[model samples]
Structures are given as C-alpha cells and as structure tokens.
Target: ITVSNIHIKSDLAIGEEVMDSLAPFIVLKGQDINTLEGLSLRQLEEGIFFMVSPNLKKFSRLRSLDLQDCNIYLQEGKTRSRTIGRAIMVRTLSCFENLVRLDLSFNYLLGCLGEILDALKLPLEFLSLRNCDLNEDDLECLANSKHALSLQELNLSKICQFSIYDNDRISSNNLFKIVFCFKNVKLLNLAQNHFQDSSIPSFCEKLPQNLKKLQYLDIAGNVLTEDSTLQICKALAKVKTFQWFRLTCSNNLLDEALGHLNQAHENAVQAKQRICGLLSALGRTDIHIEIVKLSYAIFVDLMDVMEL
Candidate 1:
C-alpha cells in the first residue's frame, strides 16, 4: 500500500496492529495472497520511522519501493543516536532482497548515494533521483555501481536546476562520462539541465553509441540550438532497436518552452519538418515520410497568436 504526505510523528501512525493486519496479504502462505511487490512510504520522517524498520523488513518480497520526499536521512550530530539512525536506515533498505524499482526523488540526499548503492545487493531496473541535490560523485558512483548494468530507466531530470550560473554546470565536467556507463538504458531523462552554450558535441557523438538500447530520451528544456537538434536527430537515428522514437520537437516543451512557441511558430514548424525529413532519410524503419506531431495546445496557441 502507498502512503503520502503523512506526518508520521508518533508510533501510533504505523503501529503494530496495522502491521499485523498486512500479514495475510503479504506473508500468509498462499500464491495469490503473497504477491505484494511494492510498498510506498512517502514523507515518513526519521523520528518514529526507525521504530518500525524491523516491521518493514517483513516486506522482504517487495520488488518496488517509493520513498520519495521522505527525509530518509540521519540528522547531523555527533551523538550515538544519529549514527544508530543512519545504520538502521541502511540496514532496513538492504533487507529488501527482490527490489527492482526505487524512486527516491526529491529526497535531498547529500553524499549518501555510495552508502545506499553499497547496501543494495540486487540491481535496480528503474531509479529516479530527480531534484535530489545530486553531485558529480553520485553520478560517478552510479556509473561504477552494479545498478549501472541493470538500470533500464533512469531520471536525473532537474538535478541541476535553478542555478545562478550555468558556468559551473556538471555537463562541463565528468557528467557525460558517467552517462556513457548506462549502455543498456532505454528511457533516459536529462531534461532541464544546463548544457554549456558551446553545446554538447560529445553528447551527439557518444549518446547513440553509448546508450544503444535507448527508446525514449527527454532533452526537452536544455535550450537546444538548431545544430544540437540536427546532431541529436542523427544520434537518435543510430539507435535502431525501438519501435517509434519521438524527438518531441516539443510541438512544445514544459511551461518553460511553451511560452516561446507563440513567437516562433513558423521557424519551429520548419525545424520540426526538417528533423522529420532527416529521420525519414536516415530511415531506421519505413515511414510515411511526413512526420510532425503538433499537440492541440500548441495548435491553439499558434492560432491565438497568428494574425488574420
């Protein structure tokens, strides 16, 4: 079961009786009854959370866990309780033997990726650490971790957002190298990141070669230049495993991109058509050849802005 926005202050929130009631569904000896694969505990804070770690371990057969925005961290102090709290957190997470999907998004976990990766014996198939205050070290650790080989879907979206200066962006450093490690990944979201204005030449060259299995790629709000667009289309055409890969062309992007669509409708359409033509020419599979998808919102936005 999933619980969210729960300010679990006291032991009564997830008391023993509640835990005991879940036994027939998760633990009792029957194939249908014991099929619980996921448990979500969003916003389950640390204070009373530690008291129930042992009870959570009963969910050993769980294959998915969502602890998004849970503040699953030890408070800073040199006290024995803090150390014990961190250890308990790790130990509890480590007990889930079959876990394949984990969403720790918006957790603000600082310098703790390595410890968590080390604890997870089984490799995760899907992981989302969006807006987690991630750094270069975390990406490096993930690239080198056992999870790297197994990860099929990864969301590192908006991890570097709201920066005062794009000059200090991670893409200018070893971040691309870390990206190269996800050779088997299918769905990869690197949206809303600061791509150095000179552009990701390395991304266009290496992305298709590195992420061969990639089906869906969301590079939506990176302020992509025309050259970057052409290059990305070329790169995407190289990966030939998936059915129909969309280059979104955004017809629009998120809120950030939607605002700009009104002024540049003609240019955007031409650009979108150009990309479709390029993909059609490159031809991973047979296409009708006139492939440009403009969402209804974009169509209406264009009509509103267009002069009669």
Candidate 2:
C-alpha cells in the first residue's frame, strides 16, 4: 500500500480503529496532513516541535513505513536541548516493533535525531534519512543506536547544511562514526553531501577498515574531483568487499578525467577478480574510453559505450 499526496484535513476523520487493519508496508509520501489531533497519533506539545503516529502499535504487522517528503511540521517553540526532542521522537517510533525498514527522507525533521535513534527498534534492516536536515547530533545518535548492527542499508545523502560550512567537519566526523557502527551494512549511500577532496584523508582513516559484506556503494555527486579520485581509490582499496561501485566525478576537471580514470584502473587492478563491476557512472557525452584491458571482464560490456 502506497499512499502518496494524501490530504487529511479533518481531525480524527481516520479513526484509530481504521489503523487496526493495515498492510505490511505503508507509504505516506508527500502528504498534507495538518495535526495528529486524533486517530491516536502521538503528539508531544511540550515546548519542542515533533509528531508521529502514536497508534502505530496498532499496525503490529507493519514491516515498512515510508514518510518521504511529507512536510511534517513541528509545534513552534525553542527547546534548549535534544533531551525532550529525543524523548518525543522515541515515543513516536518505539511502537513499531516489527518495522524492518523506515524511510523519513525529505522531511523537515530538524534536531529530532536523539529521540529517533533512541526510539528505533532492533529489527530494522534498511534506514534512510536523506535530506532531513540532520545534524551531527543525529549521526551520533545513530552511531550509538542499539540497532546499528542490524542495519543492512543506510542512506545519509544530502544530510548536511548545504548553505553553511561551519558544521561540515563535525558532521563529517559524526558520519564516519555512524559508518563505523554499522559494520555489517551491505549497501551505503552518502551522495551529494559536498564532502570535497579535503575530506578524503579523514575518509581513509575512519571508513570501516574491513567491510566483508559490503556490496553496493554510491558516493556520487559528492563534489569529488580528479585529484581526489586517486585518494578515493586508495581509500576504497581498504573496502575489499566492493562488488558494484558507482561514482560520479564530473564537471570539475573534464580534461583530467582520463587521468583519474587511468589511476582508478590502476587501483582497480588490485581487486580486479573481486570486483564484478566498476562503473564511472556519469552523464557525459564528450568523454570516452578505450578497452585498455579486454581480459578484465568487467570492462568488456562497457567497451561498446566507451566510443560514444
């Protein structure tokens, strides 16, 4: 059941009883619901702003909940610390005992990280908070979450304050901490966070030393440049579990793109047998590549596209 662009104007129009019989998966993206005044939706009106399904326990069988781009509004007022916000956030989420995947991406969920992580259950496999105005505190909460080990896929793309650079270092450190927590994660997405070449050295030092289970990684649109490409390759060399790695390093130095590719090829040669695919997945019409090594089966299929 997908419920996108839904409008719930009337209070308690959808009674608590209606939630008793819900499907395993419930998606409520781009919803325009005002207040959770009724339907048993949990509301914490204490000087802080936060809200969530209070009656989610009723949907005991629900395994997945998606609230992407819902534009959820918090009650107005400034809270001194994250304690109250975390408590309220936890209260809203703790009821979903059976949830395996939860996506709250593209929401205005500011400063609600401590509670969200504190409230998260241990059964979750996939968790995404993309573009949710997350801060370093949220990443810290995740790094300390009890369910971190259970997560298979984690998405933190575009989580930084794009307009400011004051908190970039803190956020980057917090992100690396969170990454270290989920040792068993299979797929990770950290795209478009603007962690430029300067952060590569830290990435090399903090990134999980050995993620044997990691398969797919997407670090595209991270403002990575040709000079940083080799640093990235060197860092990735530690992640021996990589199977399919997609990178988008364009627009910064098209002339030096081939040099970066050659360096990548040299680095990739070390893991040629382990890597099933290594795509420089970008949207460039002018760029081209030659079949430098036909024996490397991964590049065989991509050979045809190299000319165009």
- Model 1 stretches with alpha carbons more than 4 Å out: 1-33, 44-52, 74-82, 162-173, 197-199, 242-268, 285-308
Candidate 1 residues 103-139, lDDT tens each? 8876755556777777876998999986676566677
Candidate 2 ranges beyond 4 A from true positions: 1-55, 74-89, 163-170, 205-210, 253-308
Judge candidate 1 at residue 181 and give its lDDT.
93
TM-score of each: 0.72, 0.60
Candidate 1 has its poorest 10 consecutive residues by lDDT at: 3-12
The top-ranked prediction according to lDDT is 1
lDDT at 217 for candidate 1? 72
* lDDT (Cα, 0-100) at 9 in candidate 1: 19
